[model samples]
Target: MSDRPSPGPDVVVVGAGAVGATIAYTALVRGSARRVALHDIDAAKLEAEVLDISHGLSFTPRGSIVGSDDVEVCRGARVVVVTAGAKQKPGQTRMDLAGSTVALVRTLMPRLLEVAPDATYVMVTNPVDVVTTAALRLTGLPSRQLFGSGTVLDSSRLRHAISRRVGVAVQNVHAYVVGEHGDTEFPLWSSASLGGVPVRDWSRGHGGRLDEAELAEIADEVVHAAYRIIAGKGATNYAVALACCQIVESVLRDERRVLPVSTLLEGEYGVSGVCLSVPTVVGADGAVERLAVPMSDDEQHRLRLSAASIRATLEAVGD
Candidate 1:
């Protein structure tokens, strides 16, 4: 409708840490953009990551890469992923890092706003739920435009774990770990299935077995997987970066994938005015709609409890 040429850099990933760097590189690998800009305050890390990724560019279908600290790189980006923040400690929860990360986003958003006002802001920092909420408030961006890379990875892990226990392909297992993204998180078992078959019923008919207790144990493992990975690797970055790349691809290509990502809730599941994970439609316009998955009474109550916990974390971060 306009005379201006359409943009090509479909995504720009900020921060260049483990997560941000991986997402930028993954975008190139998937051929989701004409260009994928990688930015960060850490010049050395940015160069190293770019150099590492550049070596593989010859193998990829196609894409350009750039590393800079300039906010200008964000211009014309269809999606901007924020993955810059403090790393997590062994025993701490995601929300434990909220205060510092929230402040950091506050300082960064105004500068980013100047460059990427039209870009979808996909947050990936730890304590992502609270940091995302804070970003939305700070930028005054539309709810859909500002959301977190919420529990999608956790959900993927849940499905994978269940598949292993049930002897099914991971894709055949549709499950979600939704909520605060940490200890307060819970799986939406009521809506879970394998090839459209209810997991519980399938297990019972197959003489397979999993009780509430077992499911809880699986969830605990899913929730703490990052911590364990961090303890071993010094950071939990690549998986989340890949997750962000998935979200960016979906949005840039208008795929409309329903993923569990953190979005501001306004009366969904009887929880209002908080940011947390739920099944959502991510497409060219960012979060186009929230896919309301029916929850059992206990699931709903637990989700609300998780929301309350996130709200408390937001408060602790000075809201």
Candidate 2:
């Protein structure tokens, strides 16, 4: 069973932390998956969260919400989302939790595969691309069946910010925040358009002008937004949880949506042997393929740098 399980029971979410709880909730309420299971190392905490969400069962949707400390509940799960990692602290980058989470992933991946060997793994852990690349190397899982949430949230944030700045609907603002999910991530502005018109053209035609400096500031805000949220609430969960659900829906429904997710790269735009955010087709089989989206010279260079940074991080972690 090396393929994605047909959508059904046991879309297991590892880690009953704030993010994981929200994911299970979203999947059920939104009908992304019928059975939402959560697992955590903390037995008591896991039970508490499960009960908390399960209480809303009658109000939200017709589905089962259960959790366990045992990982085997994940056996034969259609989708396994790995959110089991050290929570990011205030002022800490996602990569900062990598060292602490490495041992967790190492111990968890094998046991998980033992039970749910064919489950499509969606890595939602911190330092997502690095962790995903490491998981791939550790388990030797098919690249298609393994990937990270990557810049989907970051891109969402950028879209929101851009729409706010341009006075347009967020849904109509077509933009992407690509590359790293961290400080070095970039906004794909060259290809950004509003309803098929270039952003600059739209602005100019509408008697508005947002200079490059302003756009850069917007992109900076997108990259650092997570840190700010973490500082305020101790963790950023709501939006990321939704992002995890987005990926889950695409995989379970075989939507074949083109999303900016973290997947392995093999010389796409001169990047190889790294898992970083790129436009990819994700569906029943996980990240099915990377799309050859055109990139500007600067964007390509930045992407290459992002790849190198992730590669370096993976190597330092002994991947």
Candidate 3:
């Protein structure tokens, strides 16, 4: 195993569960970082996960993987991705898992800061927006330095659903799922485009492919995608791990990519004091700036409603 030495790991994944392990593995394979460290309270699980991934090092890029129950493993990390939290169950919403997850983050974030104060922290736990808000309050870190994985995964799911419905490549379907990454999340259909054409205007002679009914169905699918996955499997990991890895890449490489990540809103979209997903520029410094993308009246209202939902949860959790 690689020992923690000077010029510590490029990325540190906190937690050694399926999601955490996958983030570590993905970062290594994508060359997102040279040294990836993992930490979990479960010593046995951490060791096994580290060994399992380390065994396949030859198949991946030249990188080092390490793990420990000690938070010291996270020291000097350029980016720390937290995927440790209570697992969501089949019938429960993300909010249902919030209280326990927030409590865990409350205890975990301080220790993380002690080891890697300057590291950009990404919260990948459930009800991530709330957990992120709590972390921000608990750590007093700049919003740019601490944020949530947010709806980056939700946006991907939205784009995939749109692409499938419109028979286009998912990459070309530019859409975003904004607001809370939970039941209240909604799509920014006003700005969505498919193959360089507005989604609302897409037509193949007869009628629009993304009519009102189809759009509603697609939105529902995107919002409930996680529940469906969890009902099938015990947890949803791979897609979210990839999404978290994208955020890590943007940070470690200073890519300055625009992503719909959750950040604390300070009057943007008339919402403040809550963390929710909005299109923001992410780079080495973290969520640097949020874009004031145009939204239709209905879309704006929906965003406000989403904000309200998150605010209520924050109040309930006493954050």
User: Is 1 or 3 the stronger prediction by lDDT?
Assistant: 3
The number of the candidate with the highest TM-score is 3
lDDT of 1 by residue, 1-319 (tens): 8999757357888898777787887788878776888889888888899899999999997778888877777887778888889878777778778888998998999998888888898998878888888898888898899999999899988987887776778878888889887878888989888889886668655545677777877888898888899788778766776677788889888899998989999999999888889999988888889988999999899999999998898887788
Clashes of each: 0, 0, 0
Candidate 1 residue 293 C-alpha distance from true site, Å: 1.3
Model 2 regions lying over 4 Å from their true place? 1-10, 204-207
Tell me how far the alpha carbon of residue 290 in candidate 3 is from the true structure, in angstroms, after superposition.
0.1
TM accuracy, model 3: 0.97
lDDT accuracy of residue 115 in candidate 2: 85
lDDT of 2 by residue, 1-319 (tens): 6697545355899998888888888888888888888989899999998898888888876889778888767878989999998889887787777787877889999999998888899999989888988899899998899888999999999889878877778888888878877877898888887778777666655645668888888988998998899888888888998888889999989999888999888889999888889889999988998888888999999999998888787778777
- Which of the numbered candidates is closest to the native, going by highest lDDT? 3
- List the pairs of residues colliding in candidate 1: none
Overall lDDT per candidate, in order of appearance = 0.85, 0.86, 0.91
